[model samples]
Target: MRWMKQYGRGDNFCGYYRLLHETFRIESNIERFREEFENLYPCNNSGKIGDITESYFVWEEEGDDTSELIYSVYQNNRILYKTVDPLRLLPFLEWHLNNTTLAKLDNYLQVHAGVIAKNGKGIILPASTEGGKTTLIIGLMMRGFKYLSDEVALIDPRTHNIFSFPKNLCLKEGAFNLFDPLRIGIQSKEYYVRSSKGRVCFINPERITPNAIGCPCEVAFLIFPHYNPSNPLELKKISKSEAVLNMAKRLLNLPYFQGEWLDILVELAKKAECYNISVNNLPDTVELISHLVEER
Candidate 1:
């Protein structure tokens, strides 16, 4: 079996998927992969090319037709990750597409963060993978804060305004209890027990409300969130220089844009207040953030 298809032609993000197999159940796998990313992959069929294209190709080796599958993935013809489990293929594709598209973007400064806004000002939470960004942002959104992004914080370098990426928040199975007190329930169909990132589920921001999504806004705060149940909630001010340096390390798409990102990064860091927050309780953290937002 052999198949190829492209998604997001005119948008900033795009993906191309190709599959080759000797005699595996290709139709079933293709159907499942497309269904998984249907909502996340927006269609833009203007016949125009994007800044980046996330290319993924999976192929089985010669003379290998056993139930024990060994598939390999390639990005732009270079092998990136290989695995024996086929269930992880779709999510593996998504991870590459999300990062590459953002990395290749020239128009926006992609900060590795979660963004929530109120009163036309945005809060930037710069964190890495599993940095408590999604949990904290979800708490803020439930408290009436608008969502800009759960993935990367897209910022206009010149205007200092933040745009929305607004991808679904991917949460692990263990984190489901965090939303129980808020009366949010996870549907069984949304659960993926064998994802590339392990057992996880995607929760949309609009689950809070249709108006939960936010638009571009001036940045008000740059925060780093650290979740620790053993520690009390605390917030400490950090220097703008320190904030800029720290954020630089977390940038996903800036390296592909060359040296132009330096000035943009410096300007954005100077515009927003910087802080480090250690969170023990979600409700208390939200209250502290609300008080700070109100004070500004």
Candidate 2:
């Protein structure tokens, strides 16, 4: 329970404390932790600190072997995660920060989707993890679409404008080979082994394109993407009603909007072109989306 180092920014912060004995292994990985989250929240070394609101504490267990380092993450005195691999902690921490931020955003309609923009029009790709949202986002970015987020789409309920959440893109091992031709340098980055996603890497979206971060823009299209390697690429135009239903399923903060959730989603669906795309190959899928965006 004795914390050796603390990292803080504004109200949300996390600190790493040592249990039993101090380890140099934990100290060495601090730089990597900062780099992983630098874009979202530039953590400042606050030396040592006491309890604070909305903070996460990472407890490192004492071990003779550095390779066998173990850690547990706690929030509000409750254990959130326990891991033998230090790299796995980054994703869990990132997820906590995102959810913590999203919880305070009562005004915005948050949807579990990937958002990117082109020509001042925002495109929302609504899908869950391992559903190819991040892969499609990276492919779209390579084709000149700007990156807003690879995870959540924060939409202004009144205006239907999607704001930039621009956290680093998390790529699972399965999508690593897909971007090799682009030479985005995925091979050099450190990979984390997650229980569900296997190997994962975080890459800044800017690596794909200069000034890749996009601005808030009106919803122009809602593309629901499904990845199936065995199937041929298929694109089908869907009705606004269908789009609303699909989006509603992925909406993260529905209760935050109270009774206005349905109305907000309906307006968003009405304003944007909706399509369901079944994707097999990355090149063909990107090409099809490029044409779709250009024709709009």
Candidate 3:
């Protein structure tokens, strides 16, 4: 039960902590989505991944060493599926590991992020690869904000409970030179680094997983992280409608997908502060986030 008990029910050692869902089961690593979903997706005849007009998913208790372990979701123009991984359905499983293991606690609605907590409040940094979400999260962690997701973040829309998706903080080539002085321990790489949403990836086990479910926290802010070279690090307040749209783009399908999440998001926007998190420099970004955290 090493995989089932220890790593499966584990913690992220990085910075912040998260609770893994129990329903999300781990299966054997899938080799190809096509081969595994021959009978599932029904569009197997279409050769291209883009040809999947209607998408579906499948799971297997079969894996091989050569198989690439992925956590992805897929869907069509309608009904978003956390279908990227054939054997996995949980969109926010990254909240439970410093290392990639399956099986999670069922109480959480996971989102994609690197969230750190302070005084029962958290911020969700919603962005994909090539974005500065991870960079900013890492900086916040260094300043003692509590690392949540350098990748994906999960939330219980019903309760507005923010969940953690703990992965290694990834940075690009020049990123190390930026934060190395801040005492951030990033194992240097001559080339690129492997990551969940971007380039460099780092996982801290204790920061993610735990035996019991973590309590929901208030979302003090939703800052869409963007790095502009000349733009100053300033927090621009946004309207609730705009915040909902941005959240729609960033939220994974967990508690619910489709417009079903509208009420939840609308409420979230009204309850939580929204901001256009612009950072021209990392230090300034850290300073701004620090200010926000201090408000708690």
Candidate 4:
């Protein structure tokens, strides 16, 4: 691991390593690797670095003229990934960083969802991976919804208020063409091929709305978004019991609550208006949600 220090040029440091909710150091041997992620995550020097520091070493194989790069990502002195594809490295690094940060956080009950706020009221859209959470989040942001997060919703169980995570929104290739028409500037962004999600691009939330990250707000709506090409857009109000059950499937930190997780979730559901949204077209779905938020 000490050999990694000697591989890179003098100016290969990455300064933009602080997440909104957590601080972690990232060291990389390649300057481009540092630059790419720095563009996604702008620097914040406020918080102290936690226990999860990640280091990435990327270099070309000696005497190989094919320009193939080898990369190894280490988290806390242990190897988390070793691979050859340059396009795959950033996604893996980002994924590991988010997971490690979420695991280390003890204050908030994290849920697998995209969160946004309008007029200081939070909306939680819970869904599984590749379920169009990020895509819908981008639409809402464009329509003046303040961005909280595209992945995890951090809620204070005692208060039922959702806080800001505000990580870069990662969108799949299937969404590339859909968003290009909105003039949100995705065509110029570089795309990376992920093994699980196919081609993906990372969009900094600041690009969509500068200084528009929402503050901690009481949960106003809990909408479970399901994207279906065959179905038209539909938004239906759901019971609190049903919302609690659906939310349990997406809750990431249930074990942290011991046997009280259910009570916590029930209280959360009771505080927010719940709905099941069938998503087909992006603009229509966004409009529907906007109307719901405004009417409530």
Candidate 5:
């Protein structure tokens, strides 16, 4: 994809790319996205015209209705996705870019899981949207666990270790009020917005825990978390074989079954203790996990 003018560039574990565009109005939104994501893709330079850094177009002419603005994403001249709603633009870009990053990482395995580590021991919360994964991630962060990832969990298949894939936490409007520190003691309207997921806010992890970014750590436990406000917190041991099959189903960009990668994943599951936890109290859940991490 070619554009007359380039505004910004991004590069990280994913890939290096320039965001090129001509419109100032859409450029401003791109700037906001760049501000949020550039830290993860900390390239401070823009690519030259036609330079072939993975490129994308966020073009909406000035005075155009925001709802009608259509955007296209291209990598190496191949159009990946396009949509009419501007609300999906940022997240669409993020989700694809993250997957793109994982695809290029031959040595790493990516899972649809939230991970948090402490003192070189890591816990994997294997969950999907139904599991309240983000809420549990925030609750653990409040209790002082280093933030690894709220979405994708990167694993070194060879070492059975997990690393962080940090991104802004997208909090549902309802959960925003439950966590006081996340709210910063003020109204959430300033940072809130609507998306395909409904009302949400993007939170910088640094605000809650400085240097909370997680490092590679041994995969000590595989935890499946569920949140139910009316129930008591409960943790029950699960079969490693069951954990392997279940967590394997959560692989986002891993190789197919019967492959070497599949064997590696099974090995990872076998090495770690697995459990299912129902969390009614965030504090109790945190305390329980903290003890697990602290124990021999």
Candidate 6:
């Protein structure tokens, strides 16, 4: 049996890659993507251009300074997740194919892919950054829902699709506090610490969904998480068009979602239920969504 592995371990894993629909082409391995530049190809910096996605960054560290490196979406000649570890890098590389990233180098992929599942009955929680998407998903996995990508809840361009890239959930800084009761392990040194949101590897055996399979995700609810607000957890319906726009906003890879692709995705939003979940509090936020999930 000829065996080949990408990023290490599991060449036959291509089946899962296909099922997860994580397939794309590498646009190029050039020095620089943007023309207004020089010494571009062998870059060691990170930042965002353009008026809208005008994000800022610095060459935090050299890839040579890290342990193992993997450039998932090496596009527009930008350096993302120049990690000192491969495991930390591989997930994104695996999820966002070279083709997908190339399509939306400047555009980001958006979706609250936290514990998103049909769960016998279609119930979705459209959560986002700082809304405890990971926290909520980890909690649900404890109850018996399948795991999707903790961060990138990949939406398939065809099935109007949402996919599952089940793996270890990302724990950002203080976010680890919530899992105290569960006592998830944190592997230090491996994570590429960030100023605002550093990474942590957390997986609760109790929360690990047996085989960790993917589910055809359906967002029955859109919970616009509001952490630490002086407000109660309220639910409201979101319009389909509005939902599609929001999903696009949440996409880490947005640029590629253009033309006919955008049309298909927009239609998807029109087909499902959307809700705004106001979560100013963690316990309150978790409880509110738990109740909503149970109700569905």
Badly placed stretches (over 4 Å) of model 6 are: 1-115, 118-128, 185-196, 204-209
**TM match of model 3 to true structure:** 0.58
Which of candidates 1 and 2 is the stronger one according to lDDT? 2
lDDT of residue 64 for candidate 6: 59
lDDT of 3 by residue, 1-296 (tens): 21110112122111111223211222223444232222111121223434222222223332355354334332223333333232233212232332332123233444455566666777877766666776677667666666555666666756776766544444555565665543333343222223333333232323323321223577878777887888766788889899888777765554545555777778778887888877789887888878877875
Off by over 4 Å in 5: 1-43, 46-53, 62-86, 184-186, 190-196, 254-257
N/CA/C clash count, model 5: 0
Give all candidates' CA lDDT scores: 0.69, 0.75, 0.51, 0.79, 0.66, 0.48
lDDT of 2: 0.75
Better of 2 and 4 by lDDT: 4
- Estimate TM-scores for all models: 0.72, 0.80, 0.58, 0.87, 0.75, 0.56
On TM-score, who's better, 2 or 6? 2
Per-residue error for 81 in candidate 5, Å, reads 6.3
Clashes of each: 1, 0, 45, 0, 0, 21
Residues 1-296, model 1: lDDT tens digits: 42222211121222333211011111122334555555444433332235224435554433357656465666567887676645456566556655555544547878788999999989999987777788888888888899888778887877878888766677766676788744433444455534435766666567765687787898989988888889889999999989889888888776555887788777887889899999888889999998998899
Residue range 164-272, candidate 5, lDDT tens digits? 7776676765676668755531263323334556656666677778887778888888999878888878889999888888788888766432376677777887878
Better of 5 and 6 by lDDT: 5
TM-score of 2: 0.80
**Candidate 1: stretches off by over 4 Å:** 1-35, 39-63, 68-86, 181-189, 193-196, 254-260
Candidate 4 on 1-296: residue-level lDDT in tens? 21121233346464536675455667666777767777887665343445335444443343256555557776657777767666778898788777867776757888889999999889999999978999999999989999999999998878878998877889888788777644432356477767898878888887777776888999989999999979988999899999999988887888788767788788898889999999988999999999999998
Q: How do the candidates rank by TM-score, highest first?
A: 4, 2, 5, 1, 3, 6
Strongest candidate by TM-score: 4
